[model samples]
Target: MTRRPNPFNQQAMEEVLRDLGCPESLIPSTISNYRLFVPLLFTELGEERVYQLVSRTRDELTLGEQEEAWRSSIKYIVAWAETVMEQYKHKRSNAPKSDSPDDKQPRLL
Candidate 1:
């Protein structure tokens, strides 16, 4: 079977962080956390669930009078997660599909 493309990769993560104005010193650790956290969270809860959680948390943060830096960080994180999720969905939807009727039959090995 051919391998599906991975949406969350190091270069992409780094670019997102940089685009969000993440400090150069923090990029490595932030990427590390994202690499460890994103896949495990998605695998355990699925993409939609995780996105809902993040979106809800971000909304809550917006309602309160929180510190600027903290709120901004959460906003950027949510934006990054949203971008990754969109890419994942797009890639999955475009993946090759088997049209043959026999492809759906169980193999008698």
Candidate 2:
């Protein structure tokens, strides 16, 4: 039985994202990837299995292969995020005029 994600960890994840300067668009794909790989949140895998999988994946790859794998995964996630952002922008454009991008400009406080 899969457990719900711990709200506390989720908050920490958000904080990490903010610290790393990830855009809001990347959040969903990042969450999805994390959820898929993290056994703590998914009952389908135990910690040992998760560790083993990570270890095996790492061990099988050369340095360049590992880097390429990272790039490919990031590329897919970024594409997902871009689509999300595009839809969000489209929806906001059609939404009631409340805040424009000009208003979205970073505030200096």
Clash tally, candidates in order: 0, 0
lDDT of 2: 0.57
Model 2 regions more than 4 Å off: 1-8, 13-65, 98-109
Which digits, one per residue and each the tens of the lDDT, describe model 2 over residues 45-85? 43344444545676554222454565555455545545555
Alpha-carbon TM-score of each model against the true structure: 0.34, 0.34
lDDT of 2 at 81: 49
Number of backbone clashes in candidate 1: 0
Tens-digit lDDT track of model 1 for 29-94: 777667656744555564445555656776655444344654466556656766677777789699
- Candidate 1 versus truth, CA RMSD in Å, comes to 15.0
